[model samples]
Target: MDARQKQLCIGEGFHNIDYRILKSIVDCIYEAVCVIDENGIVIVWNKGAEKLYNIAYKDIIGENIEDIFPDAIVNNVRKTGVSVENKYHSPRENSYILANSMPLYIEKVFKGAVSTDRDFAELIKLYFELENANSKLIFLENEVKKISGVFGNIIGKSPNIVKKIDMARQIAPTHASVMITGESGTGKEVFARGIHELSGRKGLFVPVNCSAIPSELFESEFFGYCAGAFTGANKKGKMGIFELADEGTIFLDEIGDMPLHMQAKLLRVLQEREIVRLGGEKNIKLDLRVLAATNKCLQEMVRESKFREDLYYRLNVVEINLPSLRERKEDIPIFIDYFIKEFSTRNSKKIIGTQRDVLNILNEYKWPGNIRELMNVIEHIIVTNKNGMIQKNSIPEYILSQAKKSESFKEYPLDLTKAIKKLETENIKKALKISKNNKSKAAKLLNIPRGTLYHKIDEYKIKCPK
Candidate 1:
């Protein structure tokens, strides 16, 4: 009978009413509850307890509790001669049932233990589902990347490179505009491509070299005009980068060199999400990702009043700074192996091996143009290699020259620009003569970085025939 019914039926003669009161108290609890006797006979089972273990009091009252539910009793309580409790599981629904047990004493000695359970199945279910979904998304993301842009993903296992890759992956799936800052040739475009592919936007990667474009062509190049919008315009108007990249990415390289007036126009388009062609009357909606890259220190430019502060803030939401090749020297070996293979296959040359001294020359030398310079060096070496393995002597003279003139100065003095130019020239000549008319080897011989040597050769108006 129910507690209230038994109490009213027995009246003053109800001596076992205390058990009814105990049952009522335990029944109100949220978790499952079970009270067992010395012989492990279940004496009391609460309502919550019944739902958890799929057992009722009527079925378990006279039954041996251990036979029906040994796990439910918490065996530790009996072994240690003390009341014990812990979390237990009911695998039917893959549920977690927390069994909180304590000693039950009939006299001065402990008789049995009473256990209670709290269901934690819901929380466990949610976590597993979230984990599974995340795994699937990551797999699909990798699969989709293969079908996108041809720009290869930057590869390296070094700590520095891995961190940058992780950060790129984290921010790629968002709509936020990105500002990438790095030294020239430090794989800025690679990171930009990664962001574009991750955002799930359609279309292509349209690269605009800000410094390469003339000031007059900026508007026409960015936003295409209508067929009859301007004089001398083509009968069939072309789609602008902004319109062409309607649902894709537009990588603006050398953004630091973009004129101030154009910066304002770019900022306006970003804010309105629309662009107007050079001589067009209507505004075209743009849904493209804007990824800007710069080798110059933009913050310093902002301080010098060259770059606008407002424009900086607008594109500063997601900023990534790429590490220079010198900063990640550990990645040099792997990158060299990659580039060697790349160039060797293309040039039909068999470059069997690279000596440690050659790698030392590459690693120790400052990489001003970063990976691009290194790749070019690898291509040059492979194309000019007479033997299967390139030895220290066979390597570029510019690198060998550094060993000879290593003691020129401990530091490069900025004030002595004339002395610097003179040293640069002498070194360049030695590299050229040693390499036997090869600018690539001569660049390595001088100990001066390759890209800087290229620019210097151009500045001095020296001709190195291809």
Candidate 2:
């Protein structure tokens, strides 16, 4: 047989063979592949190569690889008779690819080289998807830790609540100041304590309600007074909260209620990391983490000039916004079960559960006071019922009334499309607000790609207020 016939010949197992059939199999491969002779001339170019490089096999065959795909490894391997493995190369603009090239030797004589390429962009896209999935899993794990008694034994499994718990867990180990924002009964203090506990701080966790501390006494309460500092001051002298919180965490609840003058002093303390007692002359340095919580809108307060912008920015380095009980209604049942078991165990009652009607009523009513209100109602039931399951008539009068009103009230048509759009818009706005106008974080919060978020923003014409 001639040399051409020998190259086309199949092994002894095959009786009849066609070169076209072999070429067809090679062309069907997904990875770009190429073969070159010892002189660096293209001898075989598969269909994958044509699609990847946007050049036909007929155009590249018999031509020098250097003229077209100049960076092809086939040329290098042909020259040195050495194989190149897993090399990254970009043959065209925006075309990133990984390739493997090996020299072909027959009977100890150099012949040519074969190279295959895989699209790098596709691999990168898949990697990003995997990372996003891992982030979600971490969020769920952190939420599970919270309700299972790892941190303050929190209870709730709604997506928004879980996301906030996850964020707190991520930032707890750091010394960065955190701001917790939510309505009055949303358990901001609980979230703050959770952060402090997970922070692994050695010092004690001291909590102070800014609204309760009189403006005139703010300085004395925050910083301390020395002996004989004032007429009514303690004779032995008092250490300020900042001092008491050394090497620990001091939770500043209702921070937005701090007076303007006190805000200035607080900003100074944050910047200098030191404080002077009410009557002392010497400055006391502090090493502690500050976790602030508020039921009011700090940004609005900043704009209204009620809160100092500098102080707000300082304490707002890391913010965890808790969702209200009404917003995360899915967690109502969980909370109901948790609070029942808690109150029952504590009160020495054998209350097993609540009736279905009672749960429906509780879930339907908007919890204006959030979890605090929910706990109070549960305790009321446990105390009043004392035994057996809680019934509809046993619930609070206000909750039953609210549930009746909610059921009777009517809104626009319950079209699924419109409802979905409204929900989407509300979620987007919430994410943007929580992220402080950071589009990237908002996208993560919404569990969508950044590009998709941008598209939704445009479609909904959502305004980001920061």
Candidate 3:
């Protein structure tokens, strides 16, 4: 049956196979393929090759391939038996191409050459888009590097601060969980961020203000939860802080205040190098560098049974204690100038230097609030004294009040209750003097409720000295 069918087809001489089918296949391929002989004679050129080179295969065959395109530079490929790739055109207009050329080899001998090319017009457009995105990404990276206080962020001339910065830089390359310790106003978080910035991690920083979050939510907040994990959980699920900080740094601020139970969970995460989402079964591998900062001493908390002793040691691989502003007053002028300029530009104000006397007062007065307070003071000065150079007079009443705060109240024949009342009055008067009687801001600085401060003022009959 097969022989008869084949004989009938041969007799009719109608195979019906079309060459267009072959050419159609070549035209559809995105990459242009070209084949040439030893003398650089174009033997096989696909439609894609023709369209790409802007010359038809019919026009190129039997012609010297090198002389035909000129830009093809086929002579070099023939002479050297080497292929060229991604070579740019010397005089290009709207387009470019990525060429992959290979000298055709058969039985260990070079026969001719074959090439494939991809149009760069679309690729160049993509490259420009990529370049724009990369430029913006780099700018953002630079900005983040600055804010994170890496090499570029730690700005200060004071030897003490510089020494600390140098130490931080020395330790930045290691994969260590650094514990930064300092008073509430010291720049502990800055050091933590600086460590992360220096580590070259591209992940987002996840800072957990341990004191700010409610204890019940710690596990869910740090390790996240699967969908339907909790009664009111998000349907699609959530990515926890630790997951977000993967391959990056997690800054646990106020670590001393972290709850004992949460501290235990944190210890497990540190030890296991992984975390299981709350109310979920799977364990997520965590690749994170933990940087913790606290005003309260962990050793003290551990002794008091408030902090887990095990966690303390785990987090304290390296410790960087930020110096209080009082200890680093020499850095104050540097800080002051930096802050004033920043706020001036942000607030768009013309305010500049405080009087020399005021600067001296700033230097002398103990900045209990540290860097944060200094920055706020600069902002306040700019807001309040907007038009002119700041003066000693423009300095807030608080700076001046410290000197007068110790003065005793003038009274005679002091009764036990009256004497106590007089002392209270004197203290309140001093606070008013220092705060310039800005009760609200004064209350903030004093770390007390505004209502409580007002009650005390009423009870003591405190007034600003005229």
Candidate 4:
């Protein structure tokens, strides 16, 4: 060879090297490399390709490419003489890899195709982990803010409420299942969220209301499903609530509402620490804490055959019973003051504190709906009375009628104008009911001018039921 030709051959080392040396060099490449002849026969199958597809080169070389591999990109390149880059899936390896394929030509004559593949499974796993971590961080921040000062979103300082919070905090760090029992609207979710924050888990908090999910979809929603697992299934499949809640807290609100059949399934998951999808054979392991809440008496339900006995015990590792609003009446004024400020800022209102008469009446009322009802009442008062101090007349009619005031009118001063307005409102409502809500007829029934009736209706903001 001439000096220039020898330099070229040496520069391209494989051109003059032994076949074994060239094969070793190809095997050293990290990415999968494969070359096919013009007759669609496999000529080169590197070590990376064997590792990626789990197929040995000995079995693949000299074999028809179509018989050894089902990848369509190689055939497409040979047919169209075009290069293509895409994500490819290998069913044998159950893996996905980035693949690039280009037509190979010898002196402008089409020969075959060469392809390279890069596996991205590890990168995809890391991406999901980072996303899950970010979600957990956001949730923890919010939970910290909610219970930051004294009791997070729970707005009570009474002994009953404080004791419950202390118990929640004590059990927060453990992986024990917590059962929060209370009447509806007793801030059960607040305690659940607070406990999750304190637990310091590195996964997002997932809350599922047992009563909200349809019975037929319960299994699919909780355990997930594989692609083509059932008719109408998503082609890519879906992750279940438990899988999504891995390394986090799953707050199952109203656990008593879970049907008997599903309760058995839940019991198995808790016991096994794993779940098999609705239409899948694989069992997915779980690392999660379950927090359940219910207004119903689970023990009683168990006795009555309404709830599973074993599942109840599994979920009742720790129990926190929230006191009703009436049981902790001392916290009423505190909650009222806090809510007044909260709703005032939210609604851009300048209204002030509740009057003594209103506070006394509110404290005496039996709040069947608990803290949630109290918040609603406060919101209503702030929205209805935006100009001055909140008055007793702003209270809902049902509450005012049911509430037992401790001090009589003689003991506590009353607003005469408000009482008169209330009386007038009652009369106008009765007249409208009698007249079937015909404004002119109602005015005649009440012996008032139609204009006066309109003014009174606007003044009271009365909404007549149709």
List residue ranges in candidate 2 displaced over 4 A.
Answer: 1-152, 410-466
Clashing pairs in 1: 32-49, 397-445, 398-444, 398-445, 398-446, 399-444, 399-445, 431-442
Give candidate 2's TM-score.
0.56
Candidate 1 lDDT, tens digit per residue, 1-466?
4545433432322234576787789889877777665556566678987887777667666555667655554434644556555656563455567567777665466666677777776555766567556655654564465456333457677788788878878888888878988899898888888778777777787778899999988888888877876788878887887898888899999999999988999899889999887677787888888899999988999999899889988887888898899889988988888777666655556676878888877777777779988888788788888886977776567766775565356445556886777667666766776788776777677766778878988887665533
Could you give candidate 2's per-residue lDDT for residues 1-466 as a string of tens digits?
3444434322211234454675698898989888776767676678998887888866667677898767777788878777877788887678889888898766666767888888888776777567556655655565676644335467887899889888988999999999999998998888888888888888988999999988888888889999999899999999989999999899999998889988898888888999988778998888888999999999999999999888988999998888889899999999888787666655656665668888778888888898999999999998899457789988989888877777755432489888778879988999999999999999999899999999999998998975
| Candidate 2 lDDT (Cα, 0 to 1) | 0.82
lDDT of 3 by residue, 1-466 (tens): 2445433432332134353464567677878777666667665568787777677766665566667666664456767877787765531355467777777765666667777777878676776567556655665665776775665756567777788888888888788888888888787777777778788877767778989989898888888889999799999899899999998889999998888888888998899999888778888897888999899878888898888888999999988888888887788888888777666555546563568877877787788888888888878887777456988766788877863453223352358887777666766677667888888877876677889888988776666565
Residue 105 in model 2: lDDT = 69
Pairs that clash in candidate 2: none
Q: What's the lDDT for all of these models? A: 0.75, 0.82, 0.75, 0.82
Those runs of model 4 whose alpha carbons end farther than 4 Å from true positions after fitting are 1-144, 147-151, 404-466
Model 3's TM-score against the true structure: 0.56
Error of 1 at 337 (Å): 0.6
TM-score of each: 0.55, 0.56, 0.56, 0.56
How far residue 391's Cα lies from its native spot in candidate 2, in Å, is 1.1
